[model samples]
Target: MARNRYSFLVKLPTAIALIAAADQLFLGTAIGSWIGALALGWILALLLSRPALRRRPSLVALAVAAGFTGVLAHAPSLLGWVLFWSALSIAALMPRIGRFDDAWRWGLRLLAHAMTGPLAPLLDGIRLFRARPRRGRPSSSGLAALLVLPLAMTGLFLALFASANPLIARGLTQVSLPSSFSVIFWALVLLVVWPSLRPTRWATRIVARMPSADIELPGLPQATLLLSLILFNAVFALQNGLDLAFLWSGAALPEGVTLADYAHRGAYPLIATALLAGLFVLVALKPGSASAANPAIRRLVVLWVAQNLLLVASSILRTLDYVEAYSLTGFRIAALAWMGLVAIGLVLICWRMLAGRSAAWLINANALMAALALGAASVVDLDASAAAWNVRHAREVGGRGVELDLCYLSWTGPSSLLSLIELERRPLPPRFRDRVRYVRAEVLETLVRRQADWRSWTWRNQRRLDTARRLLGANPPAPAATWPGTHRECDGWIRDDPAPEPAPSVTSESDPVANAVATTTPPLTGTPSR
Candidate 1:
């Protein structure tokens, strides 16, 4: 019995390490840390697996102490390791204490068995909740209600502060948000804890039916895509503080004002553009009635065309007024054209629904158009505002010839750089290959070494810096001269340059390549790109 117990104890850590390796390969280093934590838990469980250890109150206390100590000792691995040990310890203790029935133990064992596979979805759900708690259920609703009062009060105070002193408002606008965003964050916590609070059969059935097949008809892939688009758009908008409107009444603007200021000034036009795009999508997908004999379809098409014309007119006006740039050139035009195709597809779908034509084709077309519209909207919005500060600063740093000495990059900072055109194209020195410089290397390494240290130092320090900057009305750093020069007309700078005529605006709808491809494609598909 002693030999068999010894053998089990020896094998447990190896098994945990193997699991950790697998998690690292697929789930990433952070998860590997968690697995290490879990391994520690497993070891604790093994030690407590002995009947003698279980029977002794002192040993049990020692086991718990050791588990926590291991977490602290492997400070970087605390979360994963702690969770892993806690789970195993709980598993072991459950049967020993005789609190959980055999069935409950078996259920838990089964859950543990499938834990890794379910982890991604679990994390994704957590992420979704963190992003948009308002979209989720009542468990999150309570947290939202609690937060709403404070946020409301804070917003009101900030508004009053800004109203009384515009500079204070400007400074307040710069305040860095909490590292963990509020709405989505609480939502994630709720999602994780939600299972425990899950309702009885009747309530479960009602709630389950709420997100039925029809309502979530597009399916998981499309749903995931939509969720991603919405989250990206919201994050982009919020990061830029795109809603702040200054009373322009001919106030002298400060020199070297940041793009944030520009975005704030043109917030209405930007929002209007987004709304118009959404409307265009809606119009393009309007349905028709059977008894109407295509009259409703024709009318809907006419209305859609009219609306498109109006949007185009408004966009042109906004562009001319300099309220918004005609940055809506490439993908924006394609989006409008895609909407037109969708309108046609919608008419065809309605005709099919009315005249007993194939529903499959209609479904396929609608799904395709929906995907295109979604993809287009996401790309365009991200591109339009992608050049915001964090990335712009990083680019300036690199462009100004600063060397990057980091291994891992901050997910946020690198992503921001990727959003901008100039920075993305500007090649970095080969020395920094595969290395992203966002957070300093020391900070990232320390966080990896001591996971909770992030909470103590870097995160706290950055948050404080951000808060101070906001309070002091510190503006984002200026874009380097070389950075802006990179975007200027390269063709004109050639040694044997032709005499310059008035260059066409970048937003013009004259892509010869697009037109050529459109002509070659079968009319049934509308365009090759489509």
Candidate 2:
């Protein structure tokens, strides 16, 4: 009873502050600078509501930093929002995040918190109310009954008086009540912010009730494990040997099989294989298992893991070669990062086996690596980087790369605007240069319109616009009178005729240009950036 009362009282002020903050920052306003303030407020509210959090200033600072990173692009992204909020929630709920917590446990706790957080304040209030003693006084239900008649009679008399007097009726008519939407909006704000202000320990309690991870499962027979390791090693070695010849040694692939085919086909599948191998090791060679103890099996496991690392390296090389052949994009960059993580994970698995480290140690190490990657990703704009890379390596720019992929650049939105302007200034064939300018103009128009409203502004886009303006000068190229395709494919290629018609009906459905654009797989649509 005492604890419930204390908890409710302590959190009430913080909850009210958050409600006001949310009302000011989020209600009826576009998301921009408000994101950072709201993020910081959440962290601050957590600290004030939970006294223990105040002592961990470093952790709190980390949460603040992470939350702010989400707004670095001047607008919050899905990833940014996730990192910002998750960092605060994890910091508040998982007290030993850096030291003792693993990803699986952290994820479980977060899931629990999210599921129960919204109802926490209501449940706490109920408990507090129930805990109050009646002691010969009217209980809560009786008190409600006591007020019923006076409230009803006052309402009844007021209605009668309003019926008899025009002035009273007019006053009653002028009295405004909150709209249903307003009530719902406030309720939603309370539901969303109150949970973080008074985070429930129900998640921790649930996690505590989960079964221990130490429960032993039946392990693979030593002989079966040994045979599996040998066969796996042999198969992996064969693949690595082929990669050594075709990828590293520069031996040509068999006729009709281009290097691009080899590189593209192997990159993702190899990572999947490595992941499967990691899972197999976890299940088959857990610490204290017979196969993990056998000298021969240990040797085979190390060799297999080493081969997996080599496979990961091959996959990385494959992706790089593919990127070189095609063009870089955000997804490819993430894939490369994923391959690197897989390599590190394989190393950790080997280390765990060799050093006799616990599974928890390995899981924690990998989780730390993953968290750092996500944190770094939150702050860095990969699309911008990809745009810059493509512009630099573009064949039109005299680099030995593929032709400038204007379609992809357009899909990347304003992030590619400055890059497109740079490409426009580069020495290229006259027609292609015009195409580049057209794309740049469209992107610039979108950017200028977006920046015109301060609500949608971000420093990154503003800087890009400023830089592009400096480069393009007062008179920038205008958008083509017609779009390049039915959709703004921005490929800058249409019929080979002297002049392609207007965008709406320029090309018939059977036109080769239309086919080319339509055939471009994974058709991209949507405003490139917010």
Best by TM-score: 2
lDDT of each model, Cα atoms only?
A: 0.39, 0.78
Over the stretch 90-205, how does candidate 1's per-residue lDDT look in tens digits? 43434334342233333344354334322433543444344432334343336667799999999898888898998997898799774444435443433332221111122222
Residue ranges of candidate 1 with Cα displaced over 4 Å: 1-200, 203-530
Q: Model 2: which ten-residue window has the lowest total lDDT?
A: 480-489
- Report model 2's TM-score to 2 decimal places: 0.82
Give the Å shift of residue 222 in candidate 2.
Answer: 3.1
lDDT of 1 at 49: 41
How displaced is residue 129 in candidate 2, in Å?
A: 4.1
Q: What is the C-alpha RMSD of each candidate to the true structure, in Å?
A: 28.9, 11.0
lDDT of 2 by residue, 1-530 (tens): 66656777788877777777776666566666556666776676776677666656437645565555546446567777777767667666655333435566767888998899888868876776576545676544566678999999999999999999999999999999978876777778777677666667787888877765455778878889888998999999999999999998889899999877887788888999999999899777887666788999999998999899999999999988988988999989998898889999998988888788887788788988997888777778899899999989988778888977898988788888878877777778887876787778778888898788766677777888889889988987664555343433467654433566557855567698877776675656886876
